[model samples]
Target: MSENLNPAELQKTCLYDRHVALQAKMSPFAGFMMPIQYDSITVEHNAVRQKVGMFDVSHMGEVFVEGPEAEKFVNWIFTNEIRGFEPGKVLYGMMCYPDGGVVDDLLVYREFAPDHFLLVVNAANIDKDFAWIEEHAKGFDCTVRNESPVWGQIAVQGPESEKVLADVLGLPEAANLGFYTFYDTEYKGKRMIVSRTGYTGEDGFELYTSIDGTVELWDRLIAAGVQPCGLGCRDTLRFEAGLPLYGDELSAEISPVMAGLGMFCKFDKDFIGKEALLAQKGGEIARKLVGIEIEDKAIPRAGYPVELEDGTEVGIVTTGYHSISLDKSICFALVDKAYAALDTPLSIRIRKKVFPGKVVKKRFYQTNYKK
Candidate 1:
């Protein structure tokens, strides 16, 4: 606990003190001091998928938008339809540039109050997203504020997460919260927001509470036997679950259509990139993101060359990992759309040898997302 209290001018989260108290390995992440892990990455990753684990994800960005013009402004920026979201529900969507490239993937929280909502975004894209929103909000009457510093977020994930959280937090029906939904609850007389959402494809809840509450909640969850996980485990878990990391699979250069996220785009509603998307719709995507399973013992890695059966270069791997669940080397690659189909055979250039790989389903492991 005492190891991280020195004066380094690094930003700290509400759970920073608690992490230090638990003797976590702290490191810089997205400009904030964060815990990388309490134990080994592989151990924590397995814990979350098989048993129970919790992570301090307060480093994520939070922005609140509310006003009479809120709906209109949000509709203008995001690629999904919000007309169907009821209060206490959240929607997964993306904010994009006019050219149909993603600015950031976000979860929009529909508050109980009409015209009020919260946008949870990626930490690294905070400044850029804020600027983009503000620039596009010139004539709109809504106000946007970056609230990342005011709150701390925690994710309790795994198959056992529901039972453990309910037992520890004394919130019955907490486990019953519908997937992709949120609930405003009172815990220890303090207001808390718990959402059934997470980056790891496992069933989990992302809890938002005050800084003081965050410390207490963390302690309680730990006492309830929840394993403390870190960014490394978080990444591996999401990767194994076939989830995409922002910079790895999605970037300004990759459009949602090319990334197989076209379902999130609401063509019925006009968004910033609607014109570009429409223009490119039905046209062949030059390169597409797909998953590949390596056959040889050699592991495929990011930036490794991908080639066709004839040995012609196609693309490169963007994210790769040795899946503990599948017990095989798996990778995500942006390959020529012609080879994006399932079961397509390809090879990865590893060192001087070519390792055979096949384009399988993008999701390497089955997810436990609630119905």
Candidate 2:
């Protein structure tokens, strides 16, 4: 667990006050004072899976790249192919170091023109990511600007997300968006960006608007009976859906291929870390990320040692939980390739005792993403 930081030093989002009023469990995460949960993690987790729920994701970072060479610059830095990306299209990929270690996973939104692109990154990596991109923009004939402070984001997710936005928020554009797509629209004369994207692995939409607009929209959604969810459930939801968390599933030492996310890496074009990732993809990798299911009720957690029956340590657990949706002790672990095969016997060291387990598919619950 990360040490608790001083609240006075933590940044607050536009919805900070609202979360406080709701008596949420507040914590310092990614340099921001944010809500971890409103009611209980289970309740909030189920709310989004079964009905409509809203999350104050204003802490996320946004950067813009605009110029005649925007496409080239983006393709150069990103692992995904974006050569023919049309406006309103969103691509999920990662930035990597020369050694193929992940810089950060992000979403790239091509807005109305070929020369304009929006990069939404994890809040914790805002400063580092912005600096990295800016430093690399030296000769790209483009400008890089961190627009995180100027924008507030809200995600309305789950099965009833579309209906909630259309009826409560009065945004008909929400219903028209396909998965990984977005559009610019106006609400009460204020410009907003609505995208069919979310972290919860449900059919949902993320709304990016001004700070004031976020406050107003949050209030309206609350009055319309949308459950206000927090970050605690968000982690569990994403984990169950097999979505990777930046610091956990991926990191500066963990490449995309090692984390089982190689499909997003386009090999046809040159990007930072292309050579190393290509070598990793074509040859042998020492360790690979895999899912482990503990037979006992004891929950595995991050940093827990994964061992074989002979008590030989093989890997470490990256993320784990007593899955809220599946009601099982499951986790994602970075283990030796020999131990990553399905049905391979393994043991998770939970406290003093070692629990029996086996490797399984990382997706504990099937996602309901509307494509």
Candidate 3:
């Protein structure tokens, strides 16, 4: 689903000029003028898969949580268990409605400071997620601040990302960051964070700094020959790795459990959506997300219908592509639980023709993420 945008009132990120100078294909995305691609999508996609690439993700939203009740409050609202979480650790989880529908999937970083956290959320759901967090925090003694406008972020992704961050950016501390860990430092006296995290399945890091620092860092990476990537490849890479996009695989109506992401949701801990999720667990799951591999060369796309052999529709494609890395047509579809089993035969109605397919593992490509 696309973000609501007037097109006439698109916003710009901190590195808008840099993208323009690079002659990127700019388009309105999530209320911002984002780069769809600097080079060909294939080239950029491969750059990240093989070597390194960077994205201007300054449009992503960041929210700060602080107070005496921050731990308890975050734990209550989040599906992941982070009670008495250690500083520098990052956890991926979703905030779910009481009915078990997802509010938003986000990365929550327990800051080094006591009772503080940083939540990095999707751009389209920034305001909505912040409001949801505030509304659920009525009785809690924590303060929530939307720091989206203050931070500039970039993701350095790929196999060589550690060397790039060390040699190019000269942040050797980043090389020592374990997966899902972060360390705070100063960049030109502004608070900068280097987190060993990324949307792409490859081991990488997302650096958050001030707007000016972001621009400077972007220039540095560009000058050092790091491929300036765009959202086009970002989507392909994440899709290849079977990561969920908020409005797609996971949404307000698609619970994490239905998306086969129950592992990230902690049931032992009291959470906003735990009871409903447990109820869903006890009952029949009507639908579930699954992967489909088409036999034909025709690509599957979002909104395409999935059907049984007789053309009886069961579900819709959430995201699909002719995978650049795997050289196969793969897609994630939310379908009836009866047909969600691996190897269950299915078909995708691409346009006029229905192509034969079968359910497979959602992870179409094996990831090379470093531990």
TM-score of each: 0.94, 0.98, 0.98
lDDT of 1: 0.85
List the RMSD of every prediction in angstroms: 3.4, 1.1, 1.0
Clash pairs for candidate 3: none
Residues 22-136, model 1: lDDT tens digits: 8889887666788888888889989988988999988788899989999889988998899877899899888988888889989899999899989999887888888988888
Error of 3 at 10 (Å): 1.8
| lDDT per residue as tens, model 3, 1-371 | 76646777888999999999999999888889999999999999999999999999999999999999989999998999998679999999999998999999999999999999999999988989999988877899999999999899999999999999999999987888889999999887899999999998899999999999999999999999999999999999999999999999998899999999999998888998898888777755789999999997899999999999999999999999999999999999999998999999999999899999999999888988767
Q: What's the alpha carbon RMSD for model 2?
A: 1.1
- Give, for candidate 2, the lowest lDDT window spanning 10 residues: 1-10
The CA lDDT at 317 in model 2 is 98
